[model samples]
Target: MKVDWSPLKHELGEWRAAGLTLPLWWRDDDAVAPTESLARLESLSATSGVPVHMAVIPRDATRSLADDLSDQFIPVVHGWAHVNNQTEGKKAEFGMGRDAHAARLDLQQSMARMRDLFGARLAPMFVPPWNRFDAALLPTLAEFGIDALSTYLPRQTATPIAGVTQINTHIDPIFWRGTRGLVPPDDLVAQTVALLQARRTGMQDNAEPLGYLTHHLVHDADIWEFSQQFMQEMCDGPVRLYRHDTKGFS
Candidate 1:
């Protein structure tokens, strides 16, 4: 389906007129090992000049995956394992139903395993599985050397706790509950326009880099095309790409 990107383009133009720069970042989750799909993602990032932050699952991550990472790919922890610990409700590894002590141990182990695999390449960020994390675990994140927390939607505050920074993805192209393919192009474009409008009009936190979330392993042709187009537009627009080290999260 053809997408009308004029709305997003107009919003970007407004940002330029205001002499504002939109901070943008890309994150792809659930990476375990090297695969053809992953190679495509890496190639896209290298070609588009937009770095992708790979949310590598600690338990399933491999040394080869770490070796496959280029400067364009940044590795961050994506929970202990992608397993859902909840007996009821939605899937989540770090949900409220989990025991606090067990959760802490999981967090500790997740960091250790990721550090072992990725070494110093791993960013000090935690992305809870299914983007669901218990608020009670917030304070303990810093103890495990986590500097940032990422999830879905706009973050309510820059700092949910004293030491950790909260940065979240505002747009996800997938229709997870539906066909597991791309969401309707019109809806996706409209959502992007709305998000940018909110930030441009001072209704949202513009400081938090606008994040593009993707699942490379599950992406089909449509999703890949949309991702490339969207990344190209953002790269060509008034924006600054976010970098973990230079962003002061450390």
Candidate 2:
């Protein structure tokens, strides 16, 4: 399908005219091992000059994954096991109704395991499975050395608690509840334009970098093509890409 990217391009032009550059970043979740899909992701990141902050599930993560890391990949913790602990409601590895102590232990283990695997390469970021975590656990993140928390949608506050910074993914190309394929490209572009408009008009926090979320393992051909095209457009546009170590966070 032919996609109209002019809306996004026009929105970005407005940002440039205001002497502001949109801050953007990419995050790919559920990476556990090296695969062809991951190789493509790495290649795209390298080519686009946009580093991918990969959310690796600590429990199922393998040494091969650690070994396969390239300079374009930033590793972060993605819950303990990616398993659902809740008896009802949405699937979450660290959601409400679970014992707080157990959840803390899982987080602790997540940090320890990922640290051991990724070592100095790991960014101190926590991404709860299904992007759902008990809000009560926010304050305890610092105890496990986690300084950043990422989830979906616009974050209400920059710092959810005292020390941890909250950055969130704004655009997801997948139509999860329906086809499990790419959401219509026109819809995606519309969503992007709307998000940019909100930020530009101060309806949302403009300081928080816009995050592009992906699931490499699940991406079909259309998704991959869209991702590549989107990344290229953003990189070529009037935008600044963010990294965990960048002053944008400091």
Candidate 3:
């Protein structure tokens, strides 16, 4: 299958040599339609030398694509079933600012379950559903064998958890509306450019890895092209793409 990599591997290697890395973490392996989108992203990302992180859930009510990309990027657990049992106004409450103890227990089991199934290939990173989480869950998450937690919010707690890690993205390309499918194209592009600029002007810190979230099924032709171009331009000298492992990153 063919893939669409924005800034190819050759350039990525160059960026690595220069000490700047753009860690691109893609979420949503549990979407209703996972086959075509996930496959296309994996094919494209692998070809371009971009490390795509796949978040898998045991029972997504659909096929599991984790085992399919053994030759491609790394795999992590997005969440079990990617389901949100949070309250009506707070659907994506995996990590907000409440329920420390319960969240810990919930994640503990998820971690063990994922390890039993995925083995060492599973990195200890957790991306909550809806790309939204509560801030109060991080420190507690650390105790549940979570090495890193990835979220879509730009602001996170400053408290440190010795060995645990944290990664997040400010720009989300996927479109969503009140738990709906995907959003429109123009809105996605606008968000993309805004985040790209945020990274360029140092609005986003160097310590925190940059993020871009995608849902391949929402492939509106115009938005895809714009996304491709926006990322390409953002990847020039001032912009670099790199990935950092939980333990490896300082």
lDDT of 1 by residue, 1-250 (tens): 4678888888899989999888899899999999999999999998898888899999988889888788778899999989999999988999986899999999999999998988888899999999999989997799888999999999999999889999899889999999999999889889988998899899999999899999999999999999998888877789888866545321
The lDDT values for all models are 0.90, 0.90, 0.57
Candidate 1: lDDT of 96?
89
Please identify model 1 stretches exceeding 4 Å from their true place: 246-250
Please provide, for model 2 over 1-250, each residue's C-alpha lDDT reduced to its tens digit, 9 standing for 90 to 100. Answer: 4678899888889988888778899999999999999999999999898999999999999999999889789998899999999999899888888899999888888999999998888999899989998889987788888999999999999998888999899999999999999999999999999999999999999889999999999999999999999998887677888887543331
In model 1, the worst 10-residue window by lDDT is: 241-250
The TM-score-based order of candidates, best leading, equals 2, 1, 3
Candidate 2 lowest-lDDT run of ten: 241-250
Writing each residue's lDDT as its tens digit, candidate 3 over 2-82 gives 233333444444555766655444443444334766676666565544566666664442324444555455667666666
| True-structure RMSD for candidate 2 | 1.4
Task: Indicate the residue-level lDDT of 13 in model 3.
Answer: 46
- TM-score: model 3 vs. ground truth: 0.70
Best candidate, lDDT? 2
